[model samples]
Target: MHAGGIGAPTIARTLNEEGIPNPTSYAKLTGYSWHNRPSSSLWSAGCIYSILHNETYLGTLCQGRQLTPEGQFHSKKNIPKDQWVRTVGHHPAIIDDELLRRELKARKEAGAHNLHEQKKNFPPGIFGKEVRCASCGKILTKGKTLRKTGCERTLFCPTRKKSPSHCKGAFISEKHLESAILHELKNLADRYSDDRVQIGICQDAQSADLIQEKNRLKTAVELIEKEITAYEQRSRDLYLKRATDGMSIDDFNSALSRIRNDVDKLRLKSKRASSELLHLNESIAAESIRMETVLKAADFNHLDKTKVSMLIESVYVHKRDPKSGTQAIDITWKF
Candidate 1:
């Protein structure tokens, strides 16, 4: 369907109409009852999108796309694409490279068109990308609605339309949001004036130390990556010996398991070092501005784009309480 220029939504709808079993249903049919239940039994556009983007059909094996940090339970973060271990031609191709390339191009063009339409309809507000839905952590989209009084600007989560299971949704009036932000700014200014808080201003010496640490982390990551590659190679050689040298199944399994464990450890180490390196780079690139100075000069009577950009990192708005009719707003400071 993608190769024929059918959009993901249309393909998903067609599949649902045809009574085709979705991936989760098919997995269950194959006796894989351990998988989590899907939110819906029907095909979805997101599933189609994932299928279209997957390179496994092109005979490529991709691994390490997700990593669980050490000591963390039931939580994983996506590894950067450049850090993913990929082996091309690892299996017989199910889809040609040309088809994959065409599908990718079509998806990119569709995404660009959708972004343009969204911008044209929504038109970014003062908060723009800084306001997030606390439930889903998605950036709240700006919107406008006509009321008896006049037009009202609002920020709302867009994720509800696609996956309400993740976030029922959140909405906040622009005026109310601005008021809350101004109040917070005022409080910050008052606290600074009273000498109740001290802002850590990054200096030249601190930047130099960060850069040094970054270099050290980069070296550590490279070494860890080399160790992973060596272990992977050892596993392959073991497999080859087991097949051709008539090695005992138990011994082969034991050796392969140890090598896999070592490789997993190295990958985790590389992920942590790479994460630290990324943070160091961001710290070095960020402008070293004193939060106290910005707070002292801020007017706090209204929202100023310049001041907000410099002082605030993001604002997360939670769903309103049913009984109290109040919303919780959390702000992250850039300092």
Candidate 2:
């Protein structure tokens, strides 16, 4: 095959016709564990073109050029070039400088043409990293589903498409997802308009339960303090008795030792109760602040990037039950 070809598809077709194995196929045959689904093992124009444009094949290579979000397993995206780590002579070169230049020029032209074509029908993936599968916990990807009427944009679990056993979460229509969110937001807005109603709806029951626990601990600490005071008084009385010769030295010391041990126990109990109360109060305060943030932003009718960031933390999309034809979704608010 010619190194400089007509285009990606033509080159791919030629490679396929010549019985060359695709990347995934070759990897499998050589005992490499590639993560992609078996069905995607076929050679495609996009995959072939991506390989041809990769600069790693030219010996010198840059690594850590992309990063995933901290604490998240998936959702990888490219970082700025300045942030990338560069290395020279990382591997043996497969293509020379002159060949690399020609390939880069052709790739640039092809990319521009493809971008123009894509802009005509592509829908913006507004919820890019926010939507996730509940079962497999992977980020949902956007795609277009063609129908008799036109193309409908949807989000699906990428893992499920590759293998059903991995994730069987149903595809969600972007239109439906947006509509549901809007309706829920509108409902929140209506409820939030009234202070009493807002409190009733947004108030977390866990906060109330924590307050009860806090009160119990406070009561326990007070009781322990009283017991400690009583113990100290008994020790003082014993000292007075010993000083006046009303008690023997051995008896006074023994009684004081018992009192001291009892007081120590009370003090330890008081400290534990105080610590628990403090922790409970901190939790309640944090939860209250989060709820307040949600209540403050309740007037939203439509969601934009700013609104989404402010109001929502994440959205979990569960698999749809075939019998019910309903998909379960959980929306965690930012608060």
Candidate 3:
């Protein structure tokens, strides 16, 4: 009604006049729980806004929205957007899709009455913050390029619009950028998995070397601990021999002093070795997870938000080549 001609107050008054139940009143009559008092069941602008934004009426049902740990329903848990399951066409639609779209558009215009409006003609692409200009170090915003063939998706450096002299008009086609990124990702995955690759460039080889180093350090630590134990036993034996008069007191004291010094040295070596081993192990684990993530990303056929966020840190777009008519893109991996 707000999108049509009626205002919020008029809509509320019409609902009350027609004896139609508001949300809380309807929910209460339908056996649903409403914590509010019965006196506050009248419709208002806030209620209208909530109804307009709710996805349930658009033939979609969203589940797993609440993270109810320990079965506490009242506690508000901030669940990530990705974790929510949305099932489209799971229920009957109360409104047509076109009407819903118009209402949404209207609401957006109303909300942005005093704010900067977003560009609406952007084609489908997944390069959010990942794409940037190499010359100016600013994000490349998406726009369309009109060519003799047709319209092609393009990205431009925002700084070029303000200070053209600062940047040499950094721009590139989305198709070329995506192809470069996908090629680089696939190359990385292949390099890690190929046994013929050099150890310096191979992720698997680095991981293996880290594991071997960690194991060697662990073994060294164990040897040092055994030596410390042996020294402690020898000191005990020296004390027993002194009591039995098998050796002189001065000789026993000298042996005990040497054994104690050896034990101290071995303890220090063991501490250092253990610390190094712990750090090496952590590095190995992190590298393994990173490799797994990259390999999983290589399975994607096209770019998406998830894949871009997981695989790419940033893409530097160099100036286009005049002869080859292709821009050089340097992709920095997240790992």
Q: Which number leads on TM-score?
A: 2
Q: List the residue pairs that clash in candidate 1.
A: none
- Model 3 pairs in collision: none
Candidate 3 lDDT over residue span 173-289, tens digit each = 888788888787788778666764343333466666887898899899988888888888888888888888779878878888888888888888899999999999778767767
Evaluate model 1: give its TM-score. 0.39
**Per-candidate clashes, comma-separated:** 0, 0, 0
Candidate 2 residue spans exceeding 4 A from truth: 1-47, 54-111, 114-124, 144-153, 160-169, 182-213, 319-325
Q: Write the per-residue lDDT of candidate 1 for residues 128-187, one digit (tens) a residue.
A: 788899988889977777779866789887665344554768899888998887787777
lDDT of candidate 1 vs native? 0.78
Q: Estimate candidate 2's alpha-carbon lDDT, on a 0 to 1 scale.
A: 0.73
* Count: clashes, candidate 3: 0
What is the TM-score of each predicted model, taking all chains together?
0.39, 0.60, 0.56
| Candidate No. with top lDDT | 1
Residue 160 displacement (Å), model 2: 4.3
